[model samples]
Target: MNCVKTIVCIAAVMGASANTALAQHTFSMSSEVERVENPLLTNISPGGVTVLRFAPTYAFESRGERYRSRLSLSAVIERTSDTTLLANRDFPSAGYTWGYAWPSSDLELRANLSESATRNTQFADFGRVTVDAREREFLTGARWNKEMTERTRLTLNATNRRVDYDTPLLEDYRELLLSSRVTWDHSETEAYYFEPSHSRLTPLNGGAVSTQTRWLVGTTRALSQEWSLDAFGGQSRVKGAQTETGTLGGVRLNYTGSRLTSGLEWSRDVAPIGAVSRYVRNELLGVRVGYRLTEGTSVAGRYSQSRSTDVATGRGSLFALSLDNQLAARWTSSVGVEERRSSGFGGLSGRGWAVRAGLVYSYASGL
Candidate 1:
């Protein structure tokens, strides 16, 4: 998506909101700074780095009891100390969402459109990149839901996404997805769901075109007022130059209370490899817990384990931990450490560790 296009789309939505009655607007600004050792988390070369970031956002929301709509615009500016490894980046994102439901009825309709541009590097984007690349994406989607019976509900959704990259070496693709879900309410605290989806991935550079069809069965249950569990398991069939099928599923357990919130998850899936002709199978496990020390202060930490392999790249794992604190109403900071170790093609060899500290200040107000 082009920056101009995002701006124009946001402008159009804002203009349309003017005719709607009882609309509210909000504005927020946030600034952050981080100091890091081995910033990119790469196994090859590590260096000390500092990063600065600023983000400003504007949002307009409707205040209807049933019918609702929202338009939001966000922009980001980032600067890094070591341009040779990690360059400066900027991102501009805009989105419009609208939903409607009838009073005392069990039917709903929703739609969304978004455009965004980003320039950055992420270690989890499959591999480490020595240079920064720009990417743009456009998304449009719609969903409908209806009550099938007193104990059941059905929903259908469709989405289209386009991704473009400034680096011609990276593949650009358009994705179309269609899905349906059905949920059965066994009780106030127990529910089960069945979901099926179909997706088509078409490459713009004459690469292999892939299609996937998948189905999942899942359940959600409240163990208690403050504890819950969600679990799902499924399988997917992929068709392309090479046909492949694999198991795909995940499970999550969560806790919610007055002063504590935590979650644990495990997943396995087959995902399309970026700019590559094949797909990779990934297995991941993660858990996070946080406790509020006071109204304005909290402490949290997280750990995750992942292993992935494909025809082109080997398996790798990443471990990370952090301590976070909310100093005041609008001020927050965190100290973190992470290590990456791998022993495969395109994977990290020796273990590399990085320590980081960051502070963020944000202010928000109604417009």
Candidate 2:
């Protein structure tokens, strides 16, 4: 079956079994205006462009003795001063999740389905350059977890994902992945885990299928009430039109206090680039800090740097700062500034800055 059919079937099943004692519904709406310089990070226009965006979301949830289910729908409406730069004006997204637990068997099951579309690539795992195309994705997955002993557990997961672009600049692909993990609680302060997975990626426009196998081991340690650390290392092997093997790992440290929070993270891994129909190894480092200035105000800042192992792929850095304030009982506002610089990537390198301000209104009640 196709992704749409699968998602519909899952939604039907969840709706049919929605006879629960505890149920709730929620709705929220938000609007924002942003002025960005070189919005596309290209030389097309060097002047600032203004953008207005509106977003609204709705969600329904139900819970029984041993099972819970949730469904959500959302949409984005946008207008840009330079319509030629960004074409798509509206985007719709949906998601559904259902989970159940068996106390007698010490087992739990969870399933999720989601669909989304976006024109932003800043957070995309593969793409660093801003493109003029919209990327749409469909994903469905299920997870199973079993408690084998007092201090040991096991988990299994399966997923299917598909990606498509509005333009031919990027290739469309479908991927299937199966993975398993085992965990052991060594002590009250530390836990360790091992995971292995395999995935197959096939291009829709006709090409050889790429397969990847990965093994990872990691541990989480709670150093103190306010400080914690997590570290993981892994190896990946890929086979298809081209073959390669590489090592990947990541580490993170975090701290939390009554009014202060900070974190540092670094990672290196192989990422799939559908545009090129291949994978590249990249490294990333990030630092973030946040402070509560007053009872209803807070400030946060983050810095991130990323570079590919291949010189031709290029590198980039971004610095961002934001301030958030509670304006009323159900209203909040935020203002942010961001600066970015990039080099390489076949003439896709440039520097830019942007400023944004937004307001959000939220309300919730039991149904």
Model 1 per-residue lDDT tens digits across residues 146-180: 88889998898888877777776667788888999
Candidate 1: give the clashing pairs.
Answer: none
Best by lDDT: 2
> Each model's TM-score, in the order given?
0.85, 0.91
How many clashes (backbone atoms < 3 Å, residues ≥3 apart in a chain or on different chains) does model 1 have? Answer: 0
lDDT of 2 by residue, 1-367 (tens): 2543565467668768667878788888899998878765564556777889899988888888787777776777888888775553676677777878886333333343333333245333432564656666777778888888988889988888877777677788888889999999999999999999998888899888888899999999999999999999999998888788999899999999999999999998876665655556778899999999999999999998887755227677889999999999789899999987766666656777889999998877774
Model 1 spans > 4 angstroms off: 1-24, 40-42, 103-122, 125-132, 277-279, 312-328, 333-335, 340-343, 350-367
Clashes of 2: 0
Per-model root-mean-square deviation over C-alphas: 3.5, 2.7
- TM-score of candidate 1 relative to the true fold: 0.85
